[model samples]
Each structure stands twice: as structure tokens, then as C-alpha cells.
Target: MTQIAALRVKKPDAPSSAGLLASLRGVSKAYATPAGSFMALQNIDLDIASGRFIAIVGKSGSGKTTLANLLTGIDSATSGSIRIGGVALEQKSEEELTAWRGRNVGVVFQFFQLLPTLTVVENVMLPMDFCRIGQTRDRRPRAMSLLAQLGIAEQADKLPSDLSGGQQQRAAIARALANDPQILVADEPTGNLDSHTTLEVMELFRSLTREGRTVVMVTHERDLGAFFTETVELADGQIVAIHNGEARP
Candidate 1:
């Protein structure tokens, strides 16, 4: 069966949870520039519950990506706190944060940053190799299964350069899921895709949420807001509005 069809079959039975998987409390990010300290985000508080689909929307320089980086531990907050899955992310050392993020947060980037020389399955397996997620005997099969789950199993043997843009993106998603992470963070994931491909990828994200993964995506596309259960709008480094218990505008 196709990935979409499989998702449809299993979605109804997926688990659900209350409360949050990650939260930001008075979080802010600032960088020192030639002029002075420039704040990219300010006094932000947000909660992302397990299995929720959230979209952070804003124009350029609105601090959407900065917020994502903080959540994923790529960058530290200038002040305030960030908690992920009940653990304080800011408390961990860089080494610990790296390992923790690999096991807990799966990240997808806009450009589908797959290794050009590696075959599709190899790219998916790379995360497992770095994180040492599963036993040596199990990694390949697990990667294959994940690729199959994303409906790209047939492309497993091909290099990333040989696949279509959408296929490469799907492979990247499969790589992100290699460790079965609880939270998925995406930065402008559909930015480089055509409308049809964007829909396909968004549908895949919906499927992931149905499987009880928390998905937080940053985008400027207001038309795609309906896909999210929560919408957080940012302007000038601050959260301007939050809409919950509703579809996108």
C-alpha cells in the first residue's frame, strides 16, 4: 500500500497525549552586531503539545527561524528557558545536546540537504550511524522500512542527484525519521517545492502528527495555515498573535 493509504488506515488508531512536548518561557535571542546587540526574538512563550501540528508564520526577519534554532538547540537563547520533553534543554552541555537532539528532535530543512553522493537509503541510514540508534544488524532494515513508509522505497538505490526534487525531499524526511524522534522541527520545508509537491509533503506531516509526533514548522505561506491546529504569528522579534483550537486562516 502507498504511504498515504497506510496513514489513512492507521491514523484513527494512533495515540494521543495531553500537555506539551516542548515549551519556551520568556525566550529571546540576540546577536552582537557592529551597531550593538540585536534581538531576533523577544519574551516568547509557547507550548507545543504532543501530536500537535503548529505553524510559526511571519515575514522575513520575523525571528521564526531563530525560534526554531533555539528549540532544536542549534543556538542558545540570550535569556529565558526552553524545555523539551520535560527536560531543560538549556541545561545540557553541547555534547549532551547534540546526542539528545538526535534522539528527540528530527529536523527537516528547506533545501532537502541530502548527500549528493550517497544513495537514498544510505542518506537515511546516516543519522542512525551518527546517533548509533539501533544495532548494526538492524539499521539497514529500519532505514529501508522508513523509506518505505515515506513511499520512496523504490528510490533507495538511487543517488540523491538522480531523484526528482520531491523525491529527494521525501528521502530527507525519511532520514529525519530514522531515529523515531518525538518532535519534528522543520524550517521552511515547502519553500522550494511546487504547489503539488508542497501538498504532498504537508500531507506527510499530517500523517506524522497522527502518529503522535509533535510537528513545528516555520513558514511565510499564509495560505497553508489551515494545515496547522495552532498558528503563532511573530513580528519584529515578538509574538504578535496566537490562535489555538482552530485551523489556519
Candidate 2:
């Protein structure tokens, strides 16, 4: 195992698919369009368990991003309920949700949204700053450790622009993990990378699940379904099929 991999907290084997981490029931979202209200998502009922890698897949405009946003409390549901780690999201105020989200959920976007001016390590430390997660003196070491785990610690002092696409994504993953969230939500995280980089990034995400983190990702790559513990397929904002990942009997 790589040194960083060896440093991870090894949890016991993942148990039978129990223990709900996040759930949604009758969830829907609508946006005001010039043509009037446009429904972005409708009646999504999903149950996500801890210590599993889940992939939410659909064609373009199939509400993949919308589902992720709802999971992370970024978009308000027009109807229904969302509970993550058992906390009801629909009832929390925007301000309260922001704080809760910062501490409980780590989000990764496709764009690798690192501040251009901040050094790679600083980007990772930013989450700790906002959440007040650790001692100010210890934040840098923690961020460096996360970067090392992702194999990008050598680039810590460099700006995002100086890193390769794969390295930048690695750095972003490190940042998402800054607060040690139990759940990690990623939307099209590999959309901008090349095929090899895509696989590498996916492998890193998969490893996180082994260490007891629930990973929810929105992806269009159908071929990668086999790597996930569950695959939820969406069409026109509704779930069409849910393939529970497990060895065939």
C-alpha cells in the first residue's frame, strides 16, 4: 500500500446494506423559467447507506446535478423531504444548512473550483477555516496530510494553475475531505479529465468508501457502473431503475 493509503483509518469490513446515511422521499425541485415554472426534479425517493460508493447516472439534463444538489442542501426542494445522517434538511434555514453542510458533507464539483490565487494546500485548508474544524496551527499539517493521501502533497505550495488536471482534481478531493465529513458528494467529478485520469480519480473515490465514507457521485459514464455499490438511473428527473450492487447469487 502507498504510504498515504497505509495511514488511513481502516474500518472493519462493510456490513450488509443497512444503516441509512441519506434519504429522500417525494423530493422535487422547480425553477422559475421565462416560460413559467420548469420542473428540474420530481418525486425522487432514494436511500443511501454508509460505507458505500454510489453512482447516480443519467443522460445530459437527466437531473443528475439536481439530485446531487438536493443531497448537499444546495437547492431547496419544492416538495418532500431530505434527511442526511438523519437530520431533516428541508426544515433547516439556509444559514443553518450552510453551517451543517460545511461540517457534515464534503462537496466536489467538476470544475475543480480551487481559488486561483490560493496555493494547493491553502485551498484544502479553506474548509477548515470556514468550519473551525481544527486548531489554526494544525490546519496546514492536516491539509498536507490529506494531499499526501491523494498523492499530491508535493504540489502543496503551487497554485492550482500550476498543477495538471489530474493533480488539481486530487487537490480538490483533499479539500472536500478537510472537515472529515462522513459523506462526500461529487457532481461529475471526472467530467473534465482524460480517460486514464478518470479511472485514477474513481479509484481514489472508491478507496474512500473502504475507509467508511459514503460517496455519492453523479456520473454519465455507464461503463463505470460496476465499480459502484449501487447505481441509480434517472430519466427526465425521475428514477427509472435502481441496481443494487452485490455479487450475483
Candidate 3:
């Protein structure tokens, strides 16, 4: 038998054969302008399984951010369907979406958008406070644990300005994971860091997937593709190609 066939035979059956944590079907987004409607994305169809590490890559104006925004419910789609964890986000009210996003998705931005006055641990705890994820007494411990997981526990008491760029980014990631979200959406997460720091952060993301969290990152850096299990290429506001750990042409 072929190696691929043998491997498939040896694999265990999944608890659920649905094989998807989130999906977008024929999705499109457009913005109104003086001249006409500007389409940012068109007929996007994607399926992301649980625990998968996915990277969406494209140049500026490629609609990578728009796709991420739609997936995370940061913005509404102009049309089509977005289903997350079997819940159709497109139909939810704004308040419902906010609560759903807080419980289901964790977001990391390019800029380490931490408060200047707050300490690292405090900043991490703030998300839980906003989302009301857990009891007030447990929030600090949870934040500390997340920081420790990212190898930034020692810097928890320091201010964002006091830490190095990489450390601050780690803190931001810790904050994003504060609510133990099922999905993590990051936009250019390592864009500001040096090569070494980028590697460190990428490793952390890889580990998170091992713990069964789905991760979707938007990046222009092709070098970072190695860290992901799958890569989706976007161009002209549409998916151009998908690669599963294969060498790019």
C-alpha cells in the first residue's frame, strides 16, 4: 500500500467528522464611496478546522485585514455567511457579537496596544475584567499564568514602556489569550520585532495550537509561513492559492 494510504488507515476516527471550527461561504465585503461601491473581498470561501495553524498572506491593499476583521466580527460583511463554532455570526446583534467575540476570539494587533499607565499584569487582567471571564479573585492568577506561558511572567510587574519591544508584544499576546479564547486572530503580530523576537513569538503561537486553539494570522512576511500548518494566499481581494506546508513556487 502507498504510504499515504497506510497513514490514513492508522489514523484514529475523529469525535466529530464535520472537520471545521469556522468557515466563510461566498463572503464579500464592499464599502460605499462617492464614486461607487468599492469591493474589498469577493466570494471568499474558507474552512478552518479546530487546532489548525493558518496564515493569511498578502501585500498591502490585498484585503488580508478585511478578511481578518470579518472573521473576528470586528466588522460586518457586506454579504454572505460567516459561521464560527457552528454559530452564524452574521445574524447576531451587535451586543451579542461583542459578547460572542469576547468568549470565542482572541485578537492580537500589530501595535502592542497596551495602556501606558498600566503594568504588564494589570494590562493582561484588563481583558478579563472587560469580558468578565472569571471571578474577580481569579483574574490575576489567570493573567499571570498566561504571561508565564508566554515566558513573560518575570516582566509582569513592569510597565509597557519599560520592556523591550518583543517583551511588550508578548504581553499583548498574553492579554489576547486572557479569556482562554477558542480562536486567536493576529494581524502582523511580529511586524515590529527583530528576527529573534519574531521566532520566539511564533513558537508561542505554535504551542497554542498544540493546546487545541485555532490560530489565524495575517502577515506579509513569507518567512513566517513555516510556523503555520496551512497558508492561504490572497490577491485582488480574493483567495488565490492554498498550500499545506508545501514549498511555494
Candidate 4:
């Protein structure tokens, strides 16, 4: 616990909490298995603001991933209301949710989910094609810009197989940012990389918040929490603690 104790950060210039960009109220998720129904999350209520860096951490089966999935609308909660940027998610149909999620949220998977056949820039541009975000002529420039921002512009023409793991992940992030969504959600983003690569990817995440992008990342690595404005911890499908750098009156 010394490492956790040593990471007593201070976010003196924190953003206002008056306007929540994402909210989960009375949320719960249960799955049916051979044994019985298992509760993955239980009545979780969380609020996150724009430009905040949040680390959701816990042991295995603690609902950290479930919480992320709920936020991204990748998985539906058994019960509760989920609203992101003032839009409700519960009543949306599958098609509606897909369109809405593509418009509002950007998700980065643990493994770099780039299509092996496409070039890095093409991978980034794929989102725009799927969502029809902009003109065809504009997509390539936008993709190029994202790749440049992620420090992978030089490898924009290379296939994912040719890039290093970190580079591939960076490309994936660029692809996620293609739609310019307000919220960015990542699940164990650095789980497949070395420490140095992990730091690089984490640094990129930090840079996103500075650019007014709210970032919610699930991580088991305690050390990475130091960079976040706050850490939300879970245990037994419940929020156990929140370690925050800002003080409350």
C-alpha cells in the first residue's frame, strides 16, 4: 500500500462538478450461469464531468469492466438509468444505441482492434466511414491529424502487423478519436504492453483530458492511478472507495 500512499496527488485546478457529463443511477447487472444468476454490479451511482481522468480499479470480478461496459453501452444493465451528456441510454433500441454510441462515445479496447488488412490511417478513417461523420475528402486529413497527434503519423500507411504493440494501440486510440466524441472509455488499455509502452499510452490518455476529452479507464495497475484526478474503486460489485486528489468541503 506504500505506493498508493505515496501517490497523494493534488488537483488544485479541478473542473466544476455542477455539470455531469455521465451519470449512472441505481445501476445493476446480473448474468445467468450454470450455477445461478450472478450479480456483476449492484446499484452503482457515479457521476463524471468533462475533462476528468477517472481510473476504475478493483480485483478480478469486482465489476470494474462491467462498469466500463455500462458506460460505453457495450453491455446493458439489468436495471437502472444511464445518461451520458444528458442523453438516456435505457430506452434506445439496438440500432439507436449503436448510432448514439458512435456519436457520443469513443471506446478503446484492451487489445488493439485495428483491422489487419488496413493501414493505420485507414483504420482511423473507418469510423468516419461507418458514421458518415464528414466528407470523403475530409476523412483522410482528419485521420492523418489524429495519427499525428498520437505520434504515429509516420506509420500512418503501415499495417497494424508492422507496428509495435504500443504503436498499434496508439493507432487504435486515433481511430477512437475519429468521431471526436466527448467521452473516451478504455478497458485495460495497457494490459498487453511493456512498462515503457504502458507509460507512453497512459501519457496519451492524459493529453486527451487536457484537450477537454473526459477519459474513463479501467486499470488494475495501482501506480497509474497517480495520473488520474480520482480513482473509483469497486469490491463485490459495489463501489467501495473513491480516492480523489481534490478535497471536499
Please provide, for model 2 over 1-249, each residue's C-alpha lDDT reduced to its tens digit, 9 standing for 90 to 100: 111111111111323244656667889999899999988899887766645677788888889898888888888899999887779999999999999999887899899999999999999999999989869999999999999999989999999999999999999999988988767889989999999999999999988877767678888876677678777778898887776672111
User: What's the number of clashes in each of the models?
Assistant: 1, 0, 0, 0
lDDT of 4 by residue, 129-231 (tens): 9999979999999999888888889999999999999999999998888888767889999999999999999888877776666678888886676678878
How close to the true structure is residue 199 of candidate 1, measured as C-alpha lDDT?
A: 95
Model 3 Cα shift for residue 4 (angstroms): 28
Positional deviation of residue 70's Cα in model 3 after best superposition, in angstroms: 0.7
In model 3, residue pairs whose N, Cα or C atoms come closer than 3 Å (at least 3 residues apart or on different chains), thus clashing, are none
Clashing pairs in 4: none
In Å, residue 205's CA in model 2 sits off its true spot by 0.8
TM-score of 4: 0.90
Minimum summed lDDT over a 10-residue window in model 3 is located at 1-10
| 34-77: candidate 1 lDDT, tens digit per residue | 99999999888766554467887888998989988988888889
Clashing pairs in 2: none
Where does model 1 exceed 4 Å of error? 1-18, 245-249
Ten-residue stretch with the least lDDT total in model 2: 1-10
Candidate maximizing TM-score: 4
State TM-scores per candidate: 0.90, 0.90, 0.90, 0.90
Q: Residue 213 in model 1: shift from native, Å?
A: 1.8
Q: lDDT of model 4 at residue 96?
A: 87
Model 3 error, position 11 (Å): 21
